[model samples]
Every structure is written in structure tokens, then in C-alpha cells.
Target chain A: MTLILDYEAGNLASVKRACKEVGLDAEFCADGDQLRHAERVIFPGVGAAGSAMRSLAHRGLDEALREVILRGVPVLGICLGLQVSLDHSEENDTPTLGLIPGRVRRFNLDRTDLKVPHMGWNEVVPCRPHPVLAGIDPGDEFYFVHAYYTDPKVADCVLARTEYEHSFASAVGYNSYIGTQFHPEKSGRVGLRLLANFAAWDGQC
Target chain B: MLSKRVIACLDVRDGRLAKSIKFVDTKDIGDPVEKARAYYLDGLDELVFYDITASSDRRSIMLDVVESVASQVFIPLSVGGGIRSVSDATDLRLAGAEKINVNSAAVQRPALIDECAAAIGNQNVVLSMDVRRVEPTQALPSGYEIVINGGRQPMQMDALAWALDGERRGAGELVVNSIDADGTKEGYEIALTALISSSVRIPVIASGGAGKPEHLHQVLTEGKADAALVASMVHYGEYRVSDLKEYLQRQGLKMRMSW
Candidate 1:
């Protein structure tokens, strides 16, 4: 069964609903043991990174998540879930799970034309092929709402890039771990297509 | 590039889609969930559900409506109307709303914005202001005043000042609804919208007074609004969301049409 990590930072109801819509039966799993044994894990949330890390650590889910990725279990991280998967985040100066070699930085745009948080729908151009982004086209846009963005260290780790103030890694993956800066659950049909792709993805690039 | 958003505002009253002219003389339109699904199918960028009455007793009804709509419709859903405390905002967020809009409550106690932003991130907090064009006083230099309680009470607050203040208090976006042109279909208040949009760095949604697609074009281009919120134009089935997106796209504006 597909499990969504519930660390109190995510909108679990919406994610569960989207999974059901995509014909994927999913349930909220807060137990680290349950998460480790799950066939697929969907990590999703919105909020500060420090608090999210704290909550995960408090529940011992941080180590459990790292273990899940290392075991080749399919893992998908969304929004803050994606941010906390990196090495560190500028938000709260918190250290995050080092599943991917990178750091999360806040959007420091000097242009008045672009707003921080990037709260709207924008295009996600796939830079490389990945299973989770199978049907996402060049023109397909996803819902994004975050002040900070993932900046992966290795060039090959960047799966997709979106332009706002500059081209940032909107989607990143390393080994069995896949993360997106946008919310697939909230992007309408194109977004649902992404969730369906994730449901079918077998942790293979 | 971030495309300009086209938002459909559903003024829900008694669990039904309702509409009013100048925030009075309300009329039932239809079921909100059905209309929301229809708009979602038509490739509407975002949806906003404003509980028009927002009385304390009817809070659960609004949540049920939001939950149903968010479960079926997968666009970014923003809910406003009766959010008085951080818990209220949290409840809606848990019920599947991506953003919580604070208007009268924020004006009553501005700290509610900061509190909600702290609980939920700053990105999920939206400040929706009901603005009326008034004589430019020394205190209200922008020539606009803020109204509260569904446009019934005047707050004597300057629109420009409130917009800036809302931004300072951690509001991620602003919904500037012109009380003068709410249901008039004359088009948005260009000067007022432009004033707030230019003054604040956060994205501003130009709301109220969208008669046709060209009005949206004007507001998005000349008025410099990041998004245009429509109620009457799309509510009465006069124009479909696809028609508006197609018209705006033809007029050289980027819109999200790939549903």
C-alpha cells in the first residue's frame, strides 16, 4: 500500500484525495516502521524547514526516511518535503536530510516584477527523463508556493527547471528519491497526471 | 515565466453559490461544488471561496463546501470570509485549502495575519481588502478607504496603507476588491488596482468589475495585476473560463490553458 508521511506539516487530506482520484489507495503513515515497510512513500508538506525537521526528528521519521530511500523504496517529496530532503535549508538555518547533495536557498529577487514565495502556476520544463515526470510536457504548469527553492549540487540531479527570477531546480531526483518544488496534488489535470506517474513509478530513473 | 492567473471567486452563502451587487441584494446562483468543478474543467487557474455571510454558526457548512470542492477540483484553492483566528485558518488548511484569506478580521486585529503566517507559512496567508474610492484626504492620501463586515462598516483605513501593512504583517498576496465596481461589470478600478499593485511587492489580484475578457486583459496588462478575480462574468454562464483564457491569450497575455 502507498503511504503518505504525516508529520503535521502536510495537508494530508488533499494528498489522500488526489491519490484516490488517481486510483491509488493511500493512507497516512506516521510510524517510522510503517513508513520503512511501505511500498511507496509520498512525502508532502508546506511550512518552515526547521520546524518540519524537528517534527520529523521528534517522531524519528527522519532516519526512517533516509532508510527508506537507501532501501530503494520509491519516495516522492513535495514542497517542504522536497526542501527538507536536501543537505541544508536557509530557512531557520536548519540542517536537513542529506539524501541529496544540495542546499535550499530563498529566492532573493531584486526585480519588482517577480514576487517571493512564487505563489502561482508556472511551467516545468524537463531537463532530463525521469519516471515520475513521464507525461509532463514543456507547456504543462504546476502549482508552486514557496519562498525557498532546491538547488542541487550535481547537474545530473536536476530533473526539471522552472524560470522565475532565474532558472531553479523545480524537480530533483537522486537514485530512489524524487522531489518536486511544485504541488502536483493541486495542479488540476496536469497535476493529477503527475501523481498518476508517481503512483506508477518504481523508484527507477 | 509565471503566467498571470485567472481566478473564479465563488461567493457562497448558506452553502450555495451566491452573488450580490455592491455586496448587497444577494441572489443564489447555484451549487458551489458543481460550479467549481465546471471551472476546473475549463482550465481555470485558481478558485477562491468567500463565505459571504461568514456567521459563526455556519462555519462547518463552509468547511464542508471547501472540503468537497478541494477534493474534486485540483487547482490552488483559496478560502476567505470568516477566518477570525489562527485555528480557523488552520482548520481550512487542513480541509484542503491552499491559502487562507483574512479581511475584516485582519483589519479588526492585524496580528491575526502574523499569527496565521507563523502557524501556516507566509505563502498561504492572503489579505483580501474591500476598497471604496473616496475623496483623497490627508490621512487617506491614496483616495481609497477600506470597508469591513461585507462592505457595511467603513474602517477609515487607507487602502494603500492597509495593503502595505498587510504585506508587512506577512500577507503573501493581496486581493484588492473594489466595492464601487463589485458587480457593476464596468471593469476593474484601474487606478486603484494599479496603485496597490505597484506599491506592494507581493502579487496582487485585481478583483471586482470584470464585465468581459477585455477587462481582464486591461487589468492584467495596463493595471499590472498579477491575477484577475472574476465573479459575475463567469458565474451567470455569460462567458466560460476557456473563453476568457483564449481571449487573454490572443491579446498577448500568457495563461494556463493546458488542462
Candidate 2:
């Protein structure tokens, strides 16, 4: 069964509904034991990074998530979920789990035309072949709502990129862990397909 | 490039789909869930459901309808109407709404904006203003006034000022609904939309008076709106969402055409 970590900062209902729509038998679990035994874990989050990290640490989910990743369990992070997996985030000056080698930086667009939070749908262009993005088209649009994005220190970790002011890492996959800056749960059919791909993935890098 | 969005607005009254002419002459259309699913399948960008009677009835929002629609629809769903407090925002968020829009309540108590933004993220809290054009005055310098209670009462606050205040209080997006153009099928209130869109740095959705695809294109381009919200055009089957999107795409306005 797939486990959706209820870190108290995530949109648990929408993510759960999306998983159910894609025929993925997922349950919301805040327990560490469930995270360790789950076949796949979806670490979906929203809100501020500092508060989210504090909640994760409070629930001991921070270490449990790192342990799950070390065990080679397939994990997918969404929005702030992807950010907290990085080394540090400029939002609230918070330190993260460091599951992915990167720092989350705020979008410093030179142009005044671009809006902050980067709300709405934008195209996601794949950088390399990955199982998580198997059926997703090159110009497929996914829903994104974030001011900060993950900048993977290692280029190989970036599976896809999107442009909004500048090209930022929209999707990253390192080992068995994969994450997307956009909310696949709210991205309609394309997002469902991505989640379905994750459900069927074998947790291989 | 970020494509312009075409959002379908469904006004639900007591668990059924309803439409009004400038907030009067209410008429029943169809089921909310069915219409939402149809719009979703027809390749619409997003969906907004407003419980039209919730605020006037002095009760909580219809969570059952929201839950039903959210379960069936897989796109970004924003729920509005009767969201007065942070708890209401939390309830809607838990009911699977991606965003919570506050209208009259925010004007009554601006702190609700801060409170909801604190409870949920600012990105999920939307400030939906029902604006009407009026003569320019010192107090209403922009010539547009904020209306509440389904456009029955007009607040003395200027539309531009309220928009900026909403942004200051942490509203992620602003939906400018023109009461003058509402249900008229003439076109959007370009001046009002442009005024708020230009003043605020956050994305603005131009609502009211979307008769055709050209009107949407005009609002998105000339009116300087990030998105356009439609009601009568799609609700009455006058145009399909796919056809509208194709028209916008042909007009050189980038739109997501993925099925």
C-alpha cells in the first residue's frame, strides 16, 4: 500500500482523492512505522517550510522519511514537499531534510510582468528519461503555485525543468526519491497520469 | 510561457446549480457535480463553485456539494460564498478545495484575510470583489465601488483600494467581478479589471460579462487579466469549453489544450 505522510502542512484530502482516482490504494499515516513499511510514500506539503519542518520534527517524521528513502522506498514530494527534501530553504530561513542535494531559493525575476507564487498551469519539459515522467508529454502543463523552487546542486538530479521568469527545476529524482514543484494532484489528467506512474513504479532509480 | 486560464464559475444554491441575472431572477440550471465533471472533461482550466445562498442564509457553506464536486473533478477547485472566518476556510480546505475566496466577510472584517492566510497559505486565500462602476468621487476615486451580499449593498470603499488592502492582508489572488457587466453579455468591465490588475502584483481573474471567446481574449489581453471567469456562455451550452480554448489558442493567446 502507498502511504501519504500527513505532516499537518499538506493538502491531504486532495492528494488522497487524486490517488484514489488513479486506483492507488493510499492511506494518510503520520506514524513512522507505517512510513518504514510502506511500498511507496508520497510526502506532499504546502504552507511555510519552517513550520512544516517543525511539524515533521515534532512528529519524528523528518527522520522517518530519511530512513524510508535510505531503504529504497519510492517517495514522491509535491510543492513544499519537494522544497523540504532539499538542504535548506530561503523561506523562513529553514533547514530541511537534505534528502536532495540542493537549496530552495526565492524566484528573483528581473521582469515585473511575472507574478509571484507563479500560480496556474505551466509546461514541464523533461531533461532526461525517468519512470515517474514516463507518459507525460514534453509540453504537458501542470498546475504550479509557489514563489520558491528547488535548485538541485547536482544537475543530474533534475528530471524536468519549467520556465517562469527563469527555468527552474520542476521535477527532481535522486535514487528512489522523486518530487515535483507543481501539485500533480491538482493538475487534472496529466497530474493523475504522473501519480499513476508513481503508483506503478518499482522504487528503482 | 504561462498560458492564460479559462475558469468556469458555477453558482450553487441549496445544493443545486443556479444562475442569476445581475444577482436577480435566479434560475436552476443542473447538477453541480455533473457540470463540474463536464467542464473538467471538456478541458477547462479550473473550476470555482459559489454557494450563492450560503451567506444570505446565515449558515455554513454546503460542504456536501463541495466534497461531491471535488471528488469527481480533478482540477484546481476554488470554493467561495459564506466563508466568513478562518474555521470556514479550514473546513473548505479539508473538504478538498484548493482555494478559499472571501468576499463580503473580508470587507466587514479585514482581519479575516490575515487569519485565513495564517491558517492556510496565502496562495489558497482569494479575495473575490463584486465591483460596480460609479461616478468618480473623492472617496470612490477609482469610480468603482465594492458591492457585497450578492451585489445588493454597495460598500463605500473604492475597488482599487480594497484590492490593494486585500493584497496587503495576504490575498494571493483577486477576482474582479463587475456588477455592471454581470450577465449583460456586453463584455468585461475593462477599466475596472485593468485598474485592479495593474495595481496589484498578484494574479487577477476578470469575472463577469464573458459572452464569447473573443471577450475572454480581450479581457485576458487588453483588460490585463491573468484569467477569465465565465458563467452564461458555458452554462447554457452556447459554447463548449474546448471550442473557447481553441479560439483563444488560435488568437495567439497560449492556452493548455491537453485532453
Candidate 3:
């Protein structure tokens, strides 16, 4: 069973609908106790960084999630949820729950050619093979709509990295904890396949 | 690298398409759902359904259409027309509208933008403005007073200022349609569109008066809008969506070609 953690964020309904479309017994888990029953958890978010972190903390989901992840259950974070795994962010001047040893920062490019919000489909080159990206190739594009990227200390944790003005960490994993910077739900077929592989991945925590 | 969006807008009145759309090999494309589904399969970027009947009582049926479209379609769907109150916007939201476009209602009650944006978050709320070019009349004091209710009522407001206020009110996007050049097929009102796009940071979509694929390109490169929203050109089988993308690619505009 896959439980999708529901915080105060956009795209919750879309994610739940995607899980159902993919034929997974997915339930919307609002609290930590409800999430404890699922075989895996999808911590997804869309919108500003600090507001999302505040909502997670306000619901006590942050502490509960920390406990849940420490229990060795598989947890996959998406978009802003993935950024929260980093150490800190320049947005809202707040620190994140450092699940991965890294700091989140904004895209430092000042080129007139590139837009501020990279609002489109962008592909990434896979660094290594994993069940999380089973059906997708290194060059397959995923939907992205943000201005920030994560800078992790250990390069081995990164599964795939995408390029803007410069390359950045697009996907990362440290043990049972995994996170993706792009929104697989928004991406078309390639994205659906990636979510399916993650849902059915053999790497048991 | 933002992908160029090809939107399919279905104007419904009495549960029928306001304008006819041509299908690839089908007989009579009367149903909005089927047309929308066909466009989605054809790799259209997005789909928008606007209820544009001057008079109609279709609260339940309209919502049913929205729900049915949302259930099958995966791309972003925007619905507009008669979105006056927060409750009306909520009805669409419950029916799975990814974005709500407001034109007349927004001008009448500018606060509605903020209210709706607050309820559903700003990214989903799009403030649509309809403006027509004035021929520089001496009697009229201001040039380009905002037109509302399909250009029936004109408000004493500037399009640029309204665009700025709309963005300030938490609108993630704007659809600036030119009433003057609409249906003329000459080209986009790039000057009018540029004014709005330059005023605010949010993505602006230029609508109305698209003659050919070059119009789309001109709007992108010249108007500097993030996107160009079209209805008649694509609806009347003037050009295919892929044709526009190919032309844009040939003209050196960055776009997602396949998928």
C-alpha cells in the first residue's frame, strides 16, 4: 500500500489521482498515524519553500515524519518536499530538516537568455542505475517549475542530475530516503513510469 | 526553457460548442469532450473551456462537462465565463479546474481575484482582460479604458495598471485579449500585449486576432509574452498545433518538440 502524505500544498489531488490511475491502493494520509500503516509514503509539495516547511511543522508532521523515516520505511519526497531534505534555503531564510547533507540554493544564473522560473520540460542525465528510475532513460524530460536546486555533499546520493544554465541535483537518495526535484505527476508518460518503478522498487529498507 | 502551449478552448452554449472544430477523420465534431480528447492525443499543450453563451441556465450541466473533461484529460485545464463569485470559482475547483480565467467579473470586482487566489492559491487563478485600441479621439480623455462584459461596458481604467494590480492581487498569470484586432486575422496586438507583459513579472498569455502561425511567433519574439492563446485559428482548422511548433522551431524558438 502507498500512502501519500497530504500537507497544505497544491497538487495533492493531482498526485492522489495519478496514484489511482497507476493502479496503486493509494490513500491520502493527513496525519502521521494514518501514514504508519502504508508500505511506502510519498511526501510531495508544490509552492513556496518556507510556507511548506511551516505547514509541515505546524501539523507536527515534520517530527512524525522524522520518526517515521528513522524507522527505516521507504519515504519518497517530491519537489519542495525534496528541497526540505537539504540543510537550508535562501527562501524565507529558514533551515530545512537535513535528511541529506546539503543546502538548497537558488539558481545563480543572470543570463538574459534563460527565464527566472524554468517553466517547462527538462531532461536529466542519470548518474547510476536504480529501481526509482527503471523505465526512464537519462535523457527523458520531466516537468519542472521552480528556481532553486539542491547542493548535496556526497555525489553518490544523486540518482540523476538536470542542466539549466548549470547542472544541479534533480534526484537524490540516501538509504530508505529518496527525493526528486521535478514533478513526476506533471510529466507525461515517462514521469508515470518513474512513479510506478518507485512504487514497485525492489530496494527494501 | 518554457514550452510553448497550444490551448484548445471550447465555447459552450446550451451544451453545444459555440464554434465548430474540425476533427482529423471524424464526422461532425460537435462534442467538446471528444474534441478536447482528440487535441490531447494530438499533443496539444493545454485545454481551456469557456462558457460564452450570452444567456443560459447550465449550472449542473456545465459542471458535469467540467468534471467529465477533468476526469479523462491529463493536461492543465482552464475554465472561464460567468466566474463572478468565489462560490462559482469553487464549483469549478471542485470539478477539477486547474485554472480559472476571469475577465468581466474581475473588472467589476477586483477583489474577487484575491479572494479566489487565496482560496485555491494564486498559481491557479488567471485574470483575463479584454482591451480594444482607441483611434485617439479628442472627446474621450483616457485612451484604452478597460472594456468589460464582452466589450459592452467600458471602465475608466488603464490596462497596464490593472495588469499590475492583478499581479499584486496574487494572479499567477494573465490573459490579455485584444478586442480591436479580434477575428480580423491580421496579427496579434503586440503593442498592447507588450504593455501588460512588461508591467508585471507573471506570465502573460496573448489572445485574440491570430491569423497564422507567424502570429504566434511574432507574439513570442516581439510581444514577449510567455504564451499565445488562440481559439478561432485552431478551431476553424486554419493550422494544426504541430504546425505552429514546427514553425516556431524553424524560427529558432525553444519548445518541447516531442512529448
Candidate 4:
């Protein structure tokens, strides 16, 4: 059973709906015990990193999440979920759950054309193959509404790279844990396909 | 490269999908949920739901409608109309809307943008403005004046200045709706859109007046808008979302065509 981590940061309904559409039975998991017992965990969020980390710490789900990843359980992080999995975030100057050795940095492009929040559909270019990104083709766009992006210390952890003003780690993975900066739940058909792939992903590659 | 977005605007009046000509003489067309589902199936990039009558009655948005539409549509859903507080924005977000657009209420209380930004991040807060073309004056120098109450009331505020103010107040994006070209299907107000798009660093969605794919292309390129919002063009079946996308693609504009 897949449990979606609910830390009370933003909406979980669309993520839940997307999981259902992909034939995956997912429920909100706020307690640490349920999170540890889940076969796979989907960590999704869409708000500030500071408050999100506070909520996770408040619920004691933070330590449980680190344990789940260490236990080799498949964990998928989306947007803020992915950002907070890093060591620290420039957003609100908050420290995150050090699942991956990296930092989340905000976009400070000098170009006027490349706007902050980088909102809208952009292509996700796969840097290497991974089970969760199976059906995602080259130039297949995903919905992204974020200002900050993950910068993993290990280059091999980056599964895919996307460009706005420059190349950034759009998808990163470590062992059984995977993270995507784009929202698969909101990417339409291509997004649903990614979710379907995640449902069947064994966290092997 | 990021693809230019093609968003379908659904104006809901009293729970029914409706179309308006310059914000008046609205005709109920079909069910919003069904329409949203159909558009989603047709490879639409995003969707915007405007609760047309919510402001007048001081009623909240139709969450049931948003919920039903969001259940089926996997694309990003942005909802506006009668969102006066963070609670209202939170309700829509809980109902599966990724973004909440605030127009009239935000104009009335400029701090609403700041409050919503604090509550639900700035990226999800879209500042929607309904503007009318006016002669350039000392106070309203952009020649575009911000109008509220579904274009019935003028706020005497300059549109360009308001755009900057909204961005400063933590709005991530702006939906520049032109009352002059809305539902007319002639074309978008290129000058108006270009002015705001050039002035702000945030993404600008040029709303109102899209008859064909060419108009969309024009607004995206010439008007310098990041996205184009259409209503009557797709709502009345004049053109499908695919037709518009294909046309734009052929015209050398990158679009998400994975469907």
C-alpha cells in the first residue's frame, strides 16, 4: 500500500485523485507508524519549505521518512516534497531532511524572459534511465510551478535535467528514493503515465 | 524550452457554464464539469474557472463544481471569482485547484495578495485584472484602467501600475483580461498585453478575445505574453484545443503535444 505523506502544507486532493486514476490505492499518512509500515510512500507538497518542514517535524514524520528511505522503501517526492528532502533550502533559510546530500536553491536569473516561479509546462530531459521515468519521452512536458530546484552533490543522483534559464536537476534519486521537481499529478496524460510508472516502480533503478 | 500555454477559461454563472460578451448578456451553455472533462481529454495545457456571480452575492466559489472537474481533469486548475480571503483560497486549493486567482477583492484590499501569499505560497496566487482601454491620463498613464465588478465598475487605477503593485505584493503571475476585446473574437489587445508583459518579470497570461490560433500566436509573440487565455473560441466549438495547438506548432511555436 502506498501512503501519501500529509504534513498539512498544501492540498493533497489532486495527488490523491491522480493516484486513483493510475489505479494506485493511496491514502494520506500523517502518523509516523503508518509511514514506516507502508510498502511505498508518496511525498507530495506545494507550499513554502519552512512551514512544510515545521509541520513534518511537528508530526514526527520527518524521522520516519528518513527511516523509510534508509529501509530501502520506495519514496517519491514531488515539488516541495522533493525540495525539502535535501540538506537545506534557501527558501526561508530552513534546514531540510537530509535524505540526499544537496541544497535547494531559488532561481535568481538575470534574464527578464525567464521569470521566477518558472510556472508553466517545460520539457523534462532524462539524463539517464530510471524505472519511474520509463514512459517519459524526450520533450515530454510536465507542469512546474516552483522557484527553487534541487542541487544534489552527487551528479549520478540526477535522473533528469530541465532548462529554464539554465540546466537544473528536475529529477533526482538516491538508492530507493526518487524525487521530481515537476508535478506528475497535473501534467495531464504524460503526468498520469509517470504516476502509473511510479505505481509499478520497484525502486531498483 | 518551456512551451507557451493554452488555457481554457470557463466562466460559471450560478453553477452553469456560461459565456459573456464584455461581461454582460451571459448565456448558460453546458455543465462546467463535463466541459472541463472534454477539454482535458483534448490535451489542454491548463484550465481557469471563474465564478461569475460569486462576487455580487458575496458567496464563495462553487466547490462542488471545482471538485467534480478536478476529479477528472489532470491538468492544473486555477479558480477565481469571490475569493476574498485566505480561507476562500484555501477552500479552492483543498478542492483540488492548484492556483487561486484574486481580482476584485484583491483590488479592494491590496493586502489580500500578501495574506494569501503568506498562507499558500506566492506561486499559487495569481493576480487577475479586468481592464478597459482608456485615453492616457496623468493618473492612468498606461491608457488601460483597471475595472472591477465584472467590468461594471472602474477602480480608477492604472493597469500597469497595478500589475507592478500586485507583483510586489507577492503575486506570482498576472492574468491581463481585456474588457474591450472579450467575447468579440476579433483579436487580443496586443499593446495592452505587451505593456504589462514587458513591465513585469512574472508570467503574463493574455486573456479575452481569441478567435483563432493566429490570435493566440500573435498574443504570445507580439504581445510578449507567456500564455494566452481563450473562452468563446473553444467554448462555442469554433475551434478545438488541438486545432489551436497544431496551428501554433506549425507556426514555429513549441507546445506540449505528447497527447
Per-model CA lDDT versus the true structure: 0.91, 0.91, 0.76, 0.91
Ranking by TM-score: 2, 1, 4, 3
- lDDT score at residue B9, model 3, on the 0-100 scale: 67
Which tens-of-lDDT digit does each residue in B1-259 have in candidate 2?
Answer: 7989999999988888999889998889999999999999999999999988744543344788889888888889999988889888888888888899999999999999999988898999999999998999999999999989999999998999999999999999999999999999999998889888989999999999989788999999989999999998999999999999999999999999896
Residue runs of model 3 more than 4 Å from their true location after superposition: A107-109, A112-116, B20-29, B53-59, B136-143
True contacts kept of 2: 0.70
Model 3 vs. true fold: TM? 0.87
After aligning candidate 3 to the native by TM-score, how far in Å is the CA of B188 from where it should be?
Answer: 1.8
Q: What share of the true interface contacts does each candidate keep?
A: 0.83, 0.70, 0.12, 0.84
Model 2: residues >4 Å from true position, as ranges? B54-61
**lDDT tens string, model 1, B211-234?**
989999999988999999999899
Assign candidate 3 its CAPRI class.
acceptable
Interface RMSD of each: 1.1, 0.9, 2.6, 1.0
Which of the predicted structures, 3 or 4, would earn the higher lDDT when compared with the native?
A: 4
